[model samples]
Target chain A: MQIVTNNPLVREKLQDHYAVDYAEGSFGELLVRVRDKAHLGYRLLSHPLSGSVKPNETPYKSVLISDGPGALDVESLTIIENSILTADKFPVKYPQMSAKMRADFQLIDYTLLQSAL
Target chain B: MKLELGYIDIQDIQFSEESKIANGVLYVNKDEIQKIVLGQEHIRSVEIDIARPGESVRITPVKDVIEPRVKVEGPGGIFPGVISKVGTVGSGKTHVLRGSAVVTTGQIVGFQEGIIDMAGPGADYTPFSKLNNLVLKMEPEEGLAQHEHEHALRMAGLKVATYLGELARNVQPDETQEFETYSIPEGMEKLKGLPRVAYVLMLQSQGLMHDTYVYGVDAKRSLPTIINPTEIMDGAILSGNCVSACDKNTTYHHLNNPVVMDLFDKHGKEINFVGVIITNENVYLADKERSSDWTAKLAEWLGLDGVIISQEGFGNPDTDLIMNCKKIESKNIPTVIITDEYAGRDGSSQSLADADALATAVVTGGNANELITLPKLDKVIGDVSYVERIAGGFNGNLKEDGSIVVELQAITGATNEMGFNRLSAR
Candidate 1:
């Protein structure tokens, strides 16, 4: 499986073990990258909106997807597209945080991805 | 299985030299309670406070709310595997501190913790406001990990609640209610002509801060299985979720689940209340598929003619809700899903992330995105600095005058998916 993440912790911990696609942007951007991959027939192995933490709240996210291209999975495309729409519904408001809080968010994101793995 | 819940109505709570329940008043010894909370090394300090109904108090970044309950004559203690030894607990009598609750709050572990206003327009939104809340403000050690921090707070809440529940052990209850569910064969024989119904409870188990425990076992690691509905009354399910406050089922909600209660209200009369099917909302697609498959199989195997599925948190779980609905409906078993919506601020966006035409019968717990202004209260029990960062709060959401403008999502139990709140649309 391939991991798409914007959190540095997720990339750092999983790069050696999996195909980690690191997105250097916001949480929504990471989902967009995963959506783009879904468009290329990479089936989503995890729900894009995995955690209940809203899209605009936490700044980090990590989603798992298939490592290679295959037949276009309509369900994957639909879920990713719907996830993007849902994420957009909540206006992005990435609040500034201390380094410790940032690390906490990163760790939470990494932990969520690990649950799927 | 049969269980009896004896409720000791608590009118108020006060700090005293000794802890006891008498004349509908709960007197607590603060030092003893502090000792229980500080027993864990991860926690550095804890402050105990009380917030009564109709008081001008606000508690924010709240973690979990647990009702104090003691298994008076049961095989096991309250909070089964977590606080007490693992055993069958739903078969006997349990005592409940009816009007009192233990509310846990502290340094925000995640951005999804919620707000509970004792009295205000916001008070009308949360059920916790109506309870005599014993608030615990706990601060963790300097740099505890997020997982450990959550575990510490969860344990503290359960521990304190259990400790307080002990006070009501020998007291006479004001009222007693009994709940029972029969085995599959017995149910079929007893309620010969009635429709068989079951409750599908979707637990929050997405990740570290978002999880639920069943008999002290993490629900995400288990498959969908059948459970005695009465077991829930004895604290079989506990919330370890840091999901958004508006919808996450707190331990209090689990103990007094409206769906279970309402189903029992009509049991044997309108339908045969079969049992509860516990499932988890995991992040992995395969797990979701497997759980939903098992759920459908169990429902068909139980000969359920109808089911009421209650979802915990939103977003990803919506997919599980729909999958369960569709798969179960595919078996010719009708389903009624209970959930809250995030239909945007204007209430124009789609209600759920995933949808299927088969999910036609639904019960909505209002819209979480609908915004409201909470007037500043006189006393704030927990820190309000985390307001702007909480799930439903945006930048500049907390005003200078202490009043906060936020979506209903910020209020605890505002849009509870369990039909626990009064918010709903026709």
Candidate 2:
């Protein structure tokens, strides 16, 4: 499962499951990896997991694809990877913005996909 | 190769009884620099002045801006090949005056020299406005050829910068930034799974006074060749370009290249930043074809997966930009080109002299033809008396109110092609 987020705090909170940009020498906080999905489950259960960081408007948005457990077939995996790589959000690192620049960094729309195939 | 840049921040500049840096202030010995400049046969007179940041002053018909740097422990002196012997330089430590620059200004050399505003809205567009500028107001001898005058001014700027840089030889730098590039084998091994990348730096060398010098040799006479990215940090490339003011890469820009710096920021992680390919934008079609062919061959030979190509000047050079991109992309190497537009005053005209569908990822510096009015300043540093004759200025450009209206192209570094500014179009 890949978690896509725009919130720096939410992104930072999900650190162990992902490579936080500052640690990776990158500015992006977009793609959060899940090495141990069970760890992700534990964190989600105990922490105040932000339900939907869906902003009202933004220059960018992401399509999150979440699959519940089980390994996927090869063909289905390739298609999903391609879909995730293409038709995506802005491919840049998170910019350091101030609190006063709220309207500038607002995310307008989002789509979350839960797959059962 | 490895290089260390020692930056000594100069917060202020003044002329005094002696030349030295004391407590972040630089005291220049004017007579010494004047003698060096007048050493040239064609230059009749040289006047020096200082334009500090936030001052209500404007410097016009500017030729080049150079950051004074001294190589304290390098293979060769700064500005090698031209001012110094053509020695292989790019390792060891070099000292720089971080917040200062040498600006050459005088009578117009081409329709393209620039204007530097010390204050007001126009100051926001050009980077030179921030530095403590040491302005060289030079006057050429009567009937001196434009080519000779340009050469004299170019040499003067280099020599002056070199002289100032010498002051920091023993002073300790406030900060140090190190840059290095491994050999081919080592680099390949280190970048095993990373995407291979290179920077294709296109220099303007159409020579109606437009040119760039490489290691003392003229760039227009060279084939597309590979240069160590580290070498540039030590002043391997020199700008002799006389293109329009907006996009020409001044000597200062060459020293502080943003593309090279940005690429270096991610050199080891995001991509295997290989090296740089220095090519020229020649006026002839045969030369253009040959240079582009060689550039693509070098990129392919290096096994590059992607490349960032930055351009200098506009108009005729746009063809060179397209040819370089099309040929390199033809080799199956993805490319991103950096350029500015001449999209007309209304932003409806063609942006480049040539175009292709393959050039999809273009980072525009902005529209050079867009018009802007600069308010009159309390002090005119270099002589804006002849503003109407420059490239983007018309007959009645300077008005009765002393304020002048001209295309964005009239301002120096207003739309630098290296993505140097935050200005962009919708």
Candidate 3:
């Protein structure tokens, strides 16, 4: 159920709203979910993950997503207890957050929930 | 107006020497019911069968599902205008057979009817599968027109349901609940702090056999107007449409509409439930524009801040839905439109035939074009020879093993617009 990104800065900024948690896979699955949502921005994050990712790049770099146990499949976006993400509006758009330490790679990336009331 | 509903929980139905309800089971005198059915002028005959939950049964080419109800102390009887006298109803006492229904089936065009699998993967999608159904395989006389045949089947089911409803009239109910709505001024005062909301129930009246009736008047010929939601509970509005099974609002759905119930559940709590506006989805462009215009005008006249609009069938009605949403929103009234999609099997096709940016707050009933496989059942209540030509069925839908592979649209109420089931695709 956990979907995460290695960029800990995104995690820190989002911690104020959602509790970013542990994830096990690469950012590919998260990209697919984004693409399925008709979110056009997932395109911006795809090329960087294919070995062309610059150092300390997009907030979605090295992201991982799985949705059955600990969290909701971002598609259904079930409001899980102890999870920070909510519904509808996608996670705050990337590049909007200011991380004092750009090189910190342990933070999970932002999660755009499916949709909320 | 206020209405007290008495629920008689029916656990099983069986043929007996006499028709009666006792100990949560309904016993029917087979000869008596068959006699009443044969009395219909257009119907040639009717064979009755029972299908309970967890049964290995399948009822195909199902035209309508009706919940038998009797007016114990209402202003008018049930099935107003069509059966009972045309007096205003939905006030006072009405008794309902809670866990039972009358499902009509026959040699209807495969595409026009729906399927109900009592127990299987298919059963999980249709709401009718869970009911204790008294299946009526009604046969119309030979050479009857399709429209005439459909009408005969529809009226016959209603007539039978009315008769069955009479059985519980004297039987004390297991439980009773009352629904009361405040008068216009009183509601405004009581719910002063809440936002005003109403439900715009769109009826299916696309011509041909596709239609809906209100007080015996075809909705397609009527103007968009307001009605007390409670009247619907008394069977003031009914499904006379021959639309796709998955989304058609059967008489059962109308009697127990999820949206109306949900709105009533929230009334006076967060939002002030005002009233219901009945509208039709006609094929003519003029009718579409006029009906939507009336809907918007009524919402404005009602001083509503928000409205929840539900559609019946797909395709042509999608245009009516968008027009209603856009016009209503143009009047500064926000709307939440509930509709199903026809996204292709691959899931990449456009959902609605028409769309507008104003339809932002949308609740979808899922994709009707999604495909699924129905495993073989132990019994088939009605013939399945027409499976291949059904709207959602392909040429090879009925396999040699008696299984079926078809679109979700082939199942009754699979993706109902009323949000009857908890089925939705992200």
Candidate 4:
């Protein structure tokens, strides 16, 4: 399995044990990257919208996908596409957050990823 | 199983030298609550305050809201497995301190914690605004991990609420209501002519900050199972998640689940309310498939004619809701789903992340993205600086004049999927 995330905590903590693909971008960009991977037959192991935290509300997100390519999973593609659309619906407002708040978001994202793993 | 809820009406709350209930007023000894919260070494300090109905007060970054209750004559105590010992509850009597709640607030654990405005345009969005809230502003010890911090806050609220619930043990309740559920054979025989109905409750259990507990067991780890509806009333389910503020089911919501209450109202008269099927919205695909499959299998096994599925949170859980609805409907059992929308500011975007043709009957809880401006109130209970970071809040949401602008999502229970609030779509 491979982990795709913009959360530094997930990338930093899981780099040695997992195939961590760290994306340095907004939450929406991470989903787009995941969608691109799904197009290449990487089945989604976790729901793109895993946590209840809305798409654009938090700047961090992490998703798990199959390590090896296989037959194109239409369901995975649909979910990623829908997730991107959902993320687009919310106004793009990445407000400045304090260091403490950033750590909290990272920790939450990391923990959510751990639940799926 | 049968559960009797005796409600002791609490008109007002005041801090006094001694804790007691008198003439509909709940008087609390502040020091005792402080001691209970301080027992958790991770918590540095706690400040107790009261926010009454119609007061121009705003409590931000609110964590959990719990209604105080005590098991008066039950085999098990309230919040079994967590506060009390692990045992089967839901039979016998439980006392509820109605009109009052324990509202926990402190540093922002995540961006999901919400706002509760006592009296303002914002108050209409949240049901908690109407309740006399015993607010606890707790500060955690520095360097505490997020997981530990959430646990401390959750336990503090439960412990304090349980303590307050103890006060009503000897006091006479102002009103008493009874709820009962039956075994499958008994229900089949007693209400033979009526249509069999069941409720599928989807719990929020994504991760550390977004988890729900069933008898102290994390819900995500449990498969779909049948439970007595009254079990929920006696604190069988507990909310430990920090999912979005609007739809995240607080502990109070579990204690007085509107779906259970409404279904019971129509029980026997309109239909045979059978039992409740509890399921979790897990993050993993396999877990979701397993849970949804078990849910449908159980529904079919029970021979249910109709079902009402209520979802907690949104996005990923929307997939679980649709899966449950489609699978159950495939069995020829009709379902009416209750959910809220994130239809964007213009009300144009799709409401849910997942949908199916089988999910035709739906009850909406308005739009979470519908923006609303709240005028400044006289008092602010918690730190308002966290507004710009909350789920429904944006940059420059809090104005210099003290008023704030945000989506309905920021208000606690603004669009509760359980149909708890009056907000709905045409």
For TM-score, candidate 2 versus 3, the one ahead is 3
Q: Candidate 4's residue-wise lDDT over A1-117, tens digit each?
A: 999899999988999999999979988889999999999999999998888887776788999999999999999998899888888887667757678778877887888889998
lDDT of 3 by residue, B1-426 (tens): 889999999999998998999999999888887887888778888889999988999998888899999999969999999999898988999999999999989864423458899998999898888789998898888877666777888888898899889999999999998877778899888889899999999997754456789988989779999888889999999887655788889999999998888888998788888889999876444567799999999999999999999988755567678889999999999999999887666667667656789999999898877888999999999987766655577666788888899888888899899889646642
Off by over 4 Å in 1: B108-112
| Cα lDDT tens digits for candidate 1, B1-426 | 999999999999999999999899999999999999999769999989999999999998888999999998969889989999999889889999999999999864645468999998999999999999999999999878778888999999999999999999999999999888899899889999999999999999978878999999999999999899888888999999867889989999999999999999999999999999999999999999999999999999998999999998979999999999999999999999999999999999998999999999999999999999999999998788878877888889888898999999999898999999856652
After TM-score superposition, the amount by which residue B191's alpha carbon in candidate 1 deviates from its true location, in angstroms, is 1.0
What DockQ class does candidate 2 belong to? Answer: incorrect
Docking class of 1: medium
- Report the backbone clash tally of model 2: 7
lDDT of 2 by residue, B145-169 (tens): 6667888888998999988999999
lDDT of 4 at B361: 98
Poorly placed runs, candidate 3 (over 4 Å): A1-117
lDDT of 2 at B7: 94
Q: Which stretches in model 4 have alpha-carbon errors above 4 Å?
A: B108-112
Provide the lowest-lDDT 10-residue window in model 2 chain B: B105-114
Native-to-model Cα distance after best TM-score fit, residue B204 in candidate 4, in Å: 0.5
Pairs in steric clash, model 2: A27-A93, A28-A93, A55-A107, A56-A108, A57-A107, A57-A108, A58-A108
Of the two candidates 1 and 3, the one with more favorable lDDT, higher being better, is 1
Label model 4 with its docking quality class.
medium
What TM-score does each model's chain B reach against the true chain B?
0.99, 0.97, 0.98, 0.98
